[model samples]
Every structure is written in C-alpha cells, then in structure tokens.
Target: MSIKIKDFWKAGVVCICVLMLSSCDKWVNDTELPDNTIDESQLNSIAMLGRIEKGAYIPGPVIAGVWRAGATSAADLLVASGAISDEIVPTAVPNSPFYKELDEDKLTPDNTSLFSVWSNIQNYRARAEDAILNAGSLAPADEDGVKVKQAALVNARLHAGYAWMLLADYFSVTNTSHSIYADHKELSHQEAYGKAKAYWEQAIPTASDAEKRLLHSLLAKMGIHTGNYSLAVQYINQSFGASENFSFLNTVGTVSNGFFNALNVNSRDAAVDPTLVVALKTTADKARNPVVKAAKGHWSLTLLKERDPLVVSDYEEMQLIRAELIIRGLLTGNATDLVNSVVVKYDATGLSNFPAGPALTLNDIVSIRRIFLSWRGTRLIDLRRFNIDGDLIPGFTQRKWQWIGVPEIETQK
Candidate 1:
C-alpha cells in the first residue's frame, strides 16, 4: 500500500495543534525531523500519545476532502449500503458511477467510493496501533500523566476495534477468499471480527466507565454480526442503560460531514427511496424519519447537520439489539415495549407503537430499524442480518453483492 505523505502532514499538523495544548510546544518546535516524516521517538509524551489517538479519528486524505474518519465514513457507508439495500436510490446529479454501481449491485474492485471507505478505515486502525505503541513506550512522571496515558491507550484500542469491526461488516470475501488485506495478509470476515473482539477485550482492564459501556455495546454488535445471540445478550446486558442515550461519535475537527455535504450541499448523489418517503408521510413515521427537501427535488435526512458528529453506537441501537434478542427467544423481555420505547422517544405523540401484540415479526423490527436508524449507517448490516432481497420500494430488485469487494489497489498488491 502507498502512503500519502502530504496528506498525512496536512491532517497531522492541524490535529496536533487542535488536540494538544501547551504540552505540544516541545514537539512542534523540534526542527530536526524532516517535514515529510514524523519521528516515532518524538511521540513520547502522554500529550503526544493523545494527539496521535485523536488523529486516528479525524478525516484523512481520501476522496479529496469529503471523506472523514467516523461519521463521514459512516455516512458514505450508509449511502453505499442503502443504495445496495432498499433505503436509498442513486441519483445522476453527482454523476458518480460508484453509487449507480452499488445501486445496481455491480460492485467492482475499482470502486473509488469503497476504496475511500477501506483506506480511511485502514488509516484509522494503523494510527490507533501507533498510539498503542507510543503509549507502551511512555513513562509517565505523575499520576495525572499515567491516567492520560491509560486513557489514550484505551481510546486507541476502541478505535482499532471499531476499524476491524467495520472491515468485517462492510467488505465481503471475494472469490470465496479473503474479505480484507491487512499487514500484507488477507483476513476473512470471521477472522476480522476475532481481531476486533481481542482488541476490545484488551481495553477492558484500563477502560473508564463510559468507555466500558462503549466496549460492551461494540461487543454486542459483534455478536449480532456473527449470529451469536447468546453472546449478544451477554454484552447487551452490560451496555448502556435504556434511558442513558449514550453515543460514541468520531470527531472530525474542521472536516465537513461528508454524508450531509454529499446529499444536501455538494450534490444529490443519492436520494431517499420513494418507499421510505411515502412511509414518512405518516406522522409517527415522519418523526422517526425526519427529513427535509434538499437543493434538488429529493428528500434529504435532517437527522444530522452538516457538521454533526457521526454516531458509532448509541442506546437506540442497544435497545434494538435487545429487542431482537427478545424476539429471537434468546432473552426474556417484552420486545414490543423495547421497540415502542424507541418509537415513543422519537415520535411526538407516542402513537407509533406496533398495536401492542404478538403480531410483531422480525420484519417489523427491521422496518422500524430502517426508519429510526436511517442515515445512521446500520441499514447495510441489518440487510445482511435479515438476508433481505429486493428493495423496500415495490418492483425494485436487489442485485447479488451482499458485501463490497476489496478495492483494486489492495488486490494488485
């Protein structure tokens, strides 16, 4: 893989100054290191370690300036995933064949959009590893410094874990082979998830209370992805409380939220599926699926502002996971109440409940998730979980690609 040294410097310099305080003066003033190279030894202090961890979460040079670390990447993933699934339809305005190819289920290794997602995520994982290594090398002189070092290590592990989880979720095994390439080796989906699980487990010893919740939520997601309902419930029990409203967002600093910019500001690269639009006409549905008219005639999601943080995980997702487990008979609880809890929280009049009966099927849960979790970027995983075929809109057929293939750049290596 090739490294964009210029891109690294551009993002790194801004991130170092923005994320660190006066503690960065020594590192910034050092002129011995070449402008193009960042010496690992200089990243010795706890402050520098934190800076490196934060850098992993900011937008890197991918798709020019549009693609970012957390939410932006999540947004693009939603577009591709929604296009492939039933939640979104491609538009010609952006004139990017990538969206259209995804809509038609003709994913190729050369899809730049997928490459952007792959590269940015790999960058996040790599930088996170760098932070971990730097943390290990640091010898804190004070208790506060030790805490900072520990926090940086935990945060880095969380970022690295999520990177692997995303790789496992979004990319598929090609030619009945590897799903992704890392460290010059190919990793299958299960192998990737295993790596994610290990990282999260390692962080458990030093993670704070808030970080622990995030870890459990992530572990629950991994269980869901792997069809381990028992394991999902195990972690879900240890995750955020129902009313906590916990969320983990990837901070982009000065980078624009690429998903919002694409849909509303830059161009209408993708539009809301007509099926969802019609469903949103209902009062309760409208509340859950909040959207506004874009510059073009299509509807754009208003759930996130242009600079709003991209959600990594939240309590709503935890509730949905718990509800699914209840429906699956793996856990004991009123799945209806759990589902309605989300509906009531988002809907204005609280009339969106599913008629309070046993009639709720897995499909009902999936539909509710599709609307409530629309642009949050869970649709693709949901589609894979449900083995869904055909678009939500009537008469639209889904194509064969369940997971995006490895980008061409990686394959050539």
Candidate 2:
C-alpha cells in the first residue's frame, strides 16, 4: 500500500515536443502547445491511468488463493458435502470463482465457459504487465514521481510473477489449446514451468527492496517446481534478510475484504491472477470448514479472522527452506539440529529446543513450513508441484478440470 524509494530514484520523467525549437527568439523562444499554445504543466493522462492500475495490483495474491488451503473447509457450501473435489471445494481457488484451485485434470479445451476464470487470471497478469510498462518509464524532476513509477513497476512485475506462478502450478502439463493462453498452443510441462521461472527472475532487479523480498519468495516457488530445494532455500532466505515490513495483513490485501463474494459462483476465476485462501474458525471452533487444522495447519478461533494470522515472515519461509535443504543434504550441518533451531523461532513453543537426534523427512521439514506459513497460499504451489511429480506429500490430491466442474454444470441451465 505504501511505497518508498531511495533519493536518486525519486524523480518522475515526462517529455513533450516544444514549438520553440523552430524559433530563435530570446523572450518567447520556448516550447509551444499545438500551433500557438503548449500545455507543459498538464500531467499525462496515460500515465495517470497506468498509476491507478499499478496500485490496484496489491490484491492479486490474496484473492486468487495463493495462500495455504485446508481443502476448502472455510466455505459452508463447498466443503459441507465432504467430496472436496475442485468442483465443490476450495471455492476461493486461484482459477476458480467459487472454489480455490479448480481440478484441471478433468478439463477440456474446446469448451469456452470452463476456461473463463483461468482466462481472467491470465488477463490480470497481462494488465499488471501493461501498467508497469506504461507508467514505469516515467521520469521527471519530481522526487515523488520517481518513487511512484518505481513502485508501479515493482507492483506490476510482482503481480505478473504471482499470476504466472499460479498457471504453472495448475497445468501439470501446460494447456496446448489455441484458446487457452498467449501462444494459443500450450507449452510442454517444462516449458510452462520455465516461463514462470524466467518471469520471476527477470523481476528481481527492478523490484523494490520490499518487493524484491516478495519476488524472492515467489522465485523460490519456481525452484520448488523444478525440485530445486537448494535454490528455493536461497531465494526464500534472501527475502527474510531484506524485508523489514512483512505480515499477512500487509503482504496481501483482500484477506477479508469482500473477496469471498466470488464464492457464490461455479467456475474457476482466471489463470493469471494469483490465487487466495481464506479461513473461518466458526463460532464454536469446530474446524468444520477447512477440515485439517493440525498443529501447523490449524487456525486459532480466538484470534481475529479478518487478517491472516499466519501472515508470511521471510524468517518462517527461510527456516523451512533451510530445513528442506539440510534434509536433502544440500546444507551440510545437522538437519535435526537445524530443524530444531528453525521450529523454535517458528512457533516459539517455549520447548527447551529442537532435538538433535536424526536427519528428518520431507514431511518433517514441510511440517515446519505448514505450521508457520499457514493460509498464506504457499501450500498450493507446493502441493501442485512435488505432489504432481509423484512424491507422497501429505494431503495433496491431484484434480484436473473435467466438464462437470465448469460450463457443463453451468451452461445446462
């Protein structure tokens, strides 16, 4: 919401053709608007539009359900039946309007309606990219202008990365239909994943320090897709080191801000918009909605529901990534000892310390991430990636789009 930039980067740039270039007069020998009059003071309307669009990007992550999901238990209607498929559950899904991350396995390309929300996500990403290109180029003597442009650029690029990440996660194999994406013909599984990775990497340099931290977090997500836990840890760690402002409430917008309205629908929202995951504890703390509330996955009913309590802290992600790397033998030090050190900082359970017994399992390290980064939308990516690769990660079931979840269910009416 708030933007900051260093001093030299402050000025906003603008340029206009001056009429006086044709004349050599001394007094009035300056720029002129049109034929006789030039409005040098007017702000560029295109830039103003770009500015507005840039600021609107803050909501991309939370609305799309990029945070953790407890199998769509939060929504009364979706999870009540207990099937928990993409059709009925995860209503706040990334590509779904009524669910979080629709089942893409059962999908078909010829049908237009089923593909709507997925298309919308892609649109959101395109819009953010466009806004960044338009306004991010502005430069002028105004110190505030520079900050605004830089912030806009970062916002657009970050959101772009977020959107692409969602698409990469959903299509275990990228969609090849001409109607699906920018190229019309979908890419190979590796190609789609690579595109997502490249976008996030490209964004690192232009993003602000705070944004760069977030970008690093997203980049680690890409690494996870490639099964590169070491690289994932590297990016996640950098995010923790650089970000001074990190919290669920602030890192993402629309946590409880009427984003749930879309849950009333039956189709996936869009592909390019990063997804969101929201929780409800119920008055009785029954855990009726999301179903799984284990130590790490659980939500506290006593705490406020409007903002994310499991708000992302770079430290939490760093610890988990480090633990994973250590478990994978990427980091040489004791994983058990390392896991112990990280978990304490994570929950601050006040236990004496983490046990220095034996090396840990993938689930053990993931549990640390699960407990610490709950509801922040990071889990979906994890589930979609490694789980798809045939790893036996817990609570992940692969569901692709089938006609039942989309227009087949809707267009019939």
Query: Which candidate's TM-score is highest?
Result: 1
Local distance difference test, each candidate = 0.66, 0.41
Candidate 2 per-residue C-alpha lDDT over 1-413 given as tens digits, one digit per residue, 9 for 90 to 100: 00111111111111111222223122122545334332323223223322324444322211222121111212221121112221123323345333322332434433453344443444444444544555644564564555556555565565555555544444322223311233334344456556666766776786666667777776775676568776686786666562343342322323341122322222243111111123222221122122322232222122224343323335545556666776777765666665555445433553535456655788665544443444344444455444532222123353433112322322221
Candidate 1 lDDT tens digits, 1-413? 32452345346534444353333344455556544333434445455544323423222222112223444445556556677666677764657777777767677777777788777666666666656676778788876667767777777677768778877777765635647777777778888898899999999888867778879988997898788777798889889765454333445455555456555533657766666787664566787667677666777766566666555567888888888888888888888888877777866576767777565678888888877777655777776667675354322224456777778877775
Among these predictions, the greatest lDDT belongs to 1
Error of 2 at 203 (Å): 3.4
- After superposition, candidate 2 runs with Cα above 4 Å error: 1-116, 136-144, 172-180, 183-185, 233-236, 242-304, 307-313, 345-349, 352-354, 378-413
